[model samples]
Target: MNQHVASGGTAEAIAALVSRFGDRALTGLSVRDLHAHDESHHPASRPDIVVFPNSTEEVAEIAAIANRYRVPIVPFGAGSGLEGGAIPVAGGISLDTSRLDRILDIRPDDMIVRVEAGVRRQEMNRQLRDTGLFFPVDPGADASIGGMVSTGASGTNAVRFGVMRENVLGLTVVTADGRIVRTGSLARKSSSGYDLTRLFVGSEGTLGIVTEVILRLHPIPDAVSAIAGFQTLAGAVSAVIDIKRAGLSIGRVELLDEALVAVINRHETLALAPLPTLFFEFHGNPESIATLSDVIAAIVADHGGTPLRWAKNADEARRIWETRRVGLGWAKAERPGAQSWPTDVCVPLSSLADAVLDTHADIRASQIPAYIVGHVGDGNFHCVFMSDPDDAQEQAEVHRLAGRIVVRALAVGGTATGEHGVGLGKRAFQEAEHGAEAVALMRTLKVALDPLNILNPGKILPELADPEHSN
Candidate 1:
């Protein structure tokens, strides 16, 4: 642990940063305020300065300076995370990676792409259009690749293409001492010495800062989507299990409870059935999709689900998915002047039905204006609860309901988080989910990599609150 990196003067450190980055080193309140918080309900905590690092070398230099001066470094991306992963709780230097946005390479032959950490997901996909290759880990918002990799994000496409952890092949990272290190490689598969890539994929920037990424890409599908309505949540859950059991490679299968459907209908102006519905997208040849659709239709029918609705064309398919695209927004806009507290929990396939049904009953009993929506094909679901943040009772009730849901998931051998990382919000449940021994190992890794505790402080692990170790 370097004393200079922990107790250096802020003004003196900023001067050194200015000398290195010149105009790129920013310290005005306006710039600092922009880097304070992420897209979560967590209160804003501004960094003393913000630095826009444009390359891996610059990021390495910034990291080394922070380490030398004992100033904490909080990596900043798109800041669209829901779990407060980007908030600079222990304000020091907010390292903004926006200028590093670049698609370095797209290898259609290998089906992989190399990109800078700050590249936006949508923008990178757009660039890959002509190459017939696309990165598929779409986490709804146009999040930065660095942030997505940091949180191990997965969205609608996760069921088929997999999460960030599966897609990311390697990373160019800046270690705690500002040493530039590369993990993994462009090789499709390797019996590597250590799985360092996986270690940082979901670390939430506590261990190291990712400067670049190499991601697995998928070819454009030949065929597309279908929709089905279910009378009950159990029926939808069962249908998903049946689809998987039948070995159908459905691209995406999402669940939207009646409440969420109603929100979509009201806001998106669609006439979808206000029932527990499953939205699906199937890939492969048209004949294969048609065959799989038949099996799913019969399965849905067996469970008393309504007749499946096939999208007539690409336009219609986009229209059908538009509701799902704006799901969280619609949920938030359902009630005026309400704060949105979105939480996700995942259970094993065998326990998903019971878990979802139980949580639904609990939400109804609690009387919170919350709606259930999830990537149910993979046993992950979310409930977006709308309430007034200023209301202490309402906040307490919301948290209570969220805790209950988490407990139910954990009871079924599930994780505290499925896609969303364990930021400040879920720290209390980490030990409960993964025993103290496992969490202690995680702390050991954090301390070994970031001994000064100067990287994205007060996140993920919660037991590192010693006054002597403070950044």
Candidate 2:
């Protein structure tokens, strides 16, 4: 196996890690650089070795090797994660889990599916299509289930089916010292001990590497529809709160700010009105569908929304959603020099409109190219700020804007991060967001599980979470 010759001790440790897998291991491959970084704004640091394991046994073996060698080992999925979750900043071994892609079991009767970590969310959905069951946690990146689980990701659908943390029934994870542990149960509820499953779900691979995942599936709804509510964003936000209070079961609710609408109009070559909009999907029978839409539409009008349009078929629905799924990228295209700084915040239903309006003023005052999109029914939205990462001043200003927004969210009893886990990028703000006590607790758990700090070092929680706890 080829390994990095420089960096002396770390290279040697990585080399020793490779030795455990014999010639089957790979080292110093240029592919390691590809595996080293993720889609974050952070700089990439290539791992000394990259291992693609086909089975959970191999994952355990690699983790064991890394543990023995005292080298940092980073587990990765599709590498589409926005935070620095998959990036190996402390260079050592990168355990690429993509090769483990497999559907191990599908218990349709129980509405659960057991699959290897690397299976993509869309792939699982495709396989389950004919089974009248669907796993609905979509991150809009065709992200792997492993990556999704790692970051505790949720997309536009989170307003309904919930995020990965709720959807995951159980998991087979390889802990820091390389012991395989399974948490949770297949049955609906469990008074389980410690709830390690949740502990690992959003841990971002700091505590353990998930090898397999059991996900809950919802039955296919009788109808799929998308309705666009045209309004000033404030109106759209108000309408959603009203609709939800009326006890309507909205499958999905999305908000696209005027900035996003303009960008999508140009990028997708669709002449949509350059106004804030809300998209809705309703489940259940045709009668219930009509009733909900009419009620929601009337509320939309009452809130000063106008020109509402519902998708005519699946094709139209796909077009509308495809745009929302990739709207961040499209918004960045508006400014040639800008990239995306995505901040996920969820506020209370009563305060959603104020949060959005404040975000608008923040963008204007910052004088930055930005767009906003939300899964509104749940009061969560993303402000995609287009920024110049190489410019120190610009980066600082972007982060400053983000901090203010996060502070506002927290002030209103919301969270700094709703779906995106507190990866390396969010470490500095964890104390402010979660309070010092909660952060200390997270640190204690980290030290308890990964005593040596060999797994995904410098990620999620700050430092080694006390570092002196015995394994």
Candidate 3:
């Protein structure tokens, strides 16, 4: 079976799917349009049909059908991706996993939880409230667990608990050839054969469809949160570096520029000074929390930062983090009738100040209504650009500025993206960041695992010479 099939097979594939799934498989224009794109600025490209699979067996069946007909299978989660990962660029079947929302088991003794693909983060936490444990990889959005695994996502909590690559211990994956395979184990560490769990974690659904995940959970610790204003972006970032260097187990530290701070204050109805600021959270016992708070406050004062304003209660702390969580929304609200082009990059802790300061200057000079926010504790930050979608010149400028940010990050030995996977936007920078040889090995793995290339085609890897096409 050739991997690349003519468009004619797509109709047959959709018909076969509809026959098996009945009304669950939809061919309506509205449904197709809804699955066309994600939160990305990428242009929408609808799939031929959208199928909702209910179980691991059904997902496997869908993969088999797509493989047999050589139809692309794009997995759909909550549609929260910002890089066009879920878009069916090749126009085949969009496999919606929304029906697979089941929490299989909770092993509080082992500190782990098993969940189906469609389970959202917030819902999972709610279910785990009684377990005295929680899943910590929060990308702001109440993203699906499987989607978070696919993107290898991380957010504020990543500074302490790590990302999906570290937290996910096992996966039940549906291969491109309709086979169900299990990778990793519940046991913490294993010198096993191949770390397939990590490989598929960030493949962006190009390799396989993750049906379920076994995640490592952390205990809910006593926490304290505070906000500090900085005289300059450098001061705020410098304070973060010092905090990390001090070897304190900081739970979360985020940086929001003055512009974004202003937006959040107006949108969230909070009174935070319109200055470059850092939101800090510490987790531990009451004693350790108090010590961490005092030490960090003194450090902030050393860097010309204002006195740390501690959140008085749980509600106050929630409100403080809400400002950081909705940074992109506030950016869009700051400029109505404009599309946001959000991009992020990561650098060494030593190079973070230079990278952020330079990007801030670049955004200012471009005269674009953009703001910067960062998980600076982990050397990662994001810039959201607001531009008119219909204005070609403005779009081009936004693209140019985004490209420059990536280039600067790469120059400083940083990655093009820190959290957002290379769905479509970051594909071009793969070679520059990972070198030709590394990317070639990735292509080899893609071809080996998905010979038919029916799983989420045209993502991650760039348009290199297809070995199958070469004479």
- The model with the greatest lDDT is 3
| Candidate 2, position 460, lDDT | 67
Residue 141 in candidate 3 has what lDDT? 91
TM-score of 3: 0.97
Which of the two candidates, 2 or 3, achieves a greater TM-score against the reference?
Answer: 3
- Ten-residue region with minimum lDDT total, candidate 3: 1-10
Better structure of 2 and 3 per lDDT: 3
Q: What does each candidate score in C-alpha RMSD?
A: 2.2, 3.5, 2.2
* Residue-by-residue lDDT tens digits, candidate 1, 172-220: 9998889999999999988978999999999999999999999999988
Candidate 2: regions farther than 4 A off:
1-9, 20-24, 463-471
Q: What's the TM-score of every candidate structure?
A: 0.97, 0.94, 0.97
Candidate 1 stretches greater than 4 Å from native? 1-5, 469-471
Give the lDDT of residue 121 in candidate 3.
95
Ranking by lDDT: 3, 1, 2
